[model samples]
Target: MTHKIAILGASGYTGAELVRLIATHPSMEIVALAANSKAGMAYEDVFPHLRHLALPDLVKIEEIDFDNVDLVFCGLPHATSQSVIKALPKSVKVVDLSADFRLRDPEEYVKWYGGQHDALECQAEAVYGLTEFYRDDIKNARLVAGTGCNAATGQYALRPLIEAGVIDLDQIILDLKCAVSGAGRSLKENLLHAELSEGYHPYAIGGTHRHLGEFDQEFSAIAGRPVKVQFTPHLVPANRGILATVYVQGDAQAIYDTLQKTYADETFIQVLPFGKVPSTRHVRGSNFCHIGVSGDRIEGRAIVTAALDNLTKGSSGQALQNANLMLGEEENAGLMLAPCFP
Candidate 1:
């Protein structure tokens, strides 16, 4: 049975990505596309690359009939989804690709997002959208909160080790490099071609990046204690990936075994051979996450690196994965495309 899908924030980067992937999905069909700012315009006008596919014209959210949509992919900005999703029909499953409902605690939501959540009831029932770890919950959820791209990259590297107690929780450190598109389609001085093409620098140093809230929430929960990792994100000139090099104190071989075993059955996550590091180029434009592990010359240190397309595996692709489970379809349906390689 084909499920009807509607995409909110269809003019943005993740929105276009959802359209790109779902266009080939056998069990999913795009029925509506909403982009309030670009309402009454053609979707191809907003994203020229997608001009080849026939799609619904961009419309205001209020104009779409939710009762007809089987699932809704909320690609709207943070805080925007809370109110918009609150008004949607509860029968339609939702996968939110924003930071709004990711944090379970309302206070943490306010602390990081600087506003109280408007839809407390929905937030309460929302399952976290880390597909591999929360598959069962996602299958039964009406709402799933998609993780932050940076947060997702970091977690893919650390969650297994943390769960197996193979690393020092207190000493974990994540150094991440993110592509420019992760900043969203909006224009900013820092993201312009002139300022970003030749250089890269860290921005959220000293544990201040908003994704830390996610690390704190997820990591702490797994360790059964407060686990805070020093995280720093740098913006690179590339357009579509995230590479996180995590430093941890653990048995390198053990860490590798744990990750290999943990993801042995996952369709999208690939654990590269030992000592073989992953590159963003390999996983670009695909729903795949490649992870590599190596030991440092020093006695007790290990480096774990993970690479994925920030827009695909990290956001829209992930949203679609959870949507598959929620709708009782094949988990890997429409998601098995191989990575784009040069």
Candidate 2:
């Protein structure tokens, strides 16, 4: 029952994270590691923290032998994953960490991503990888698209309320702050230490952030109507985690009760005691998501906060969760490690 896993783009943060988690998975093993730019280098050379593990030397995606791989983690960049994944062996289960197959509609893909989906067939078959809501679908999907870190954060706060009909559909607003690591390992002018430290700024304001497509698609489906929220994402200097504050119009107590009841049986989602908010530090390096609710000054409104390590629950850990479902293993296996604390 051992599953052989390959990580394409292993030099990146999320890919490195996949290696870290899979290193402990009882049913999975890392058989191939691909990093086009870092090809032929030992994995430990690029990530010294992983020096203790026995891992494959980095190879280019085209050089991999998918015949022996049971699963592939596509951690490539946005437009890049589609083509790369389409080229992977059809029998290999894929958990794409990019935005390639996340949006259901091809038109929406072009609208948000600014190009035609290179793999329409794959897009059509890919299951949304929000493990809690799409557990059954993920279990049988050949391709699973991981949710956007920001999108996952907002949904954890609002999905239950929307599904239970306890909140106003038109009044949702998501204000999220994410760590720089969410930007990926690619070099960026703004992500440099000198520029990013001691500064933070909100980009993609006014419903323009690409993740809004996910929010609109999922929330609208839950409410059985078009549900668009005012979403703004800010880039912070920290290296990992996402903190989302959601504003919803609803009875404060009702909103709290709804979230608590909805997540009571879920292992990775934690609903904090009412009125007690969660912090990003509490969930860092773990797949767990912490949600807290409090009443706003207005009686009919409430604020819901959710926090999780963007690289863990937000990306790689989520990918692993879906892979477990695909492999028919325990949903939380290899993911029970507690969050790293300060």
How many backbone clashes can be found in candidate 1?
A: 0
Kindly list the per-residue Cα lDDT of model 1 for residues 178-259, writing each as its tens digit. 9999999987998889999999999987978899999999999999999999999999999999999999999999999999
Give the least accurate 10-residue stretch of model 2, judged by summed lDDT.
204-213
TM-score of each: 0.99, 0.99
lDDT of model 2, residue 299: 79
TM-score of model 1 vs. true structure: 0.99
Please list all clashing residue pairs in model 2, or write none if there are none. Answer: none
lDDT of 1 at 172: 92
Residues 1-342, candidate 2: write the lDDT tens digits.
899989998999998999999988998988899999999999999999999999989998888889999999999999999998888879999999999999999999999999988999999999999999999999999999999999999998999999999988988888999999998888899999999999899998777889999998999999899999998899999989999999889998999999999999999999999899999999999999999999999879999999999999999999999999999999998899899999
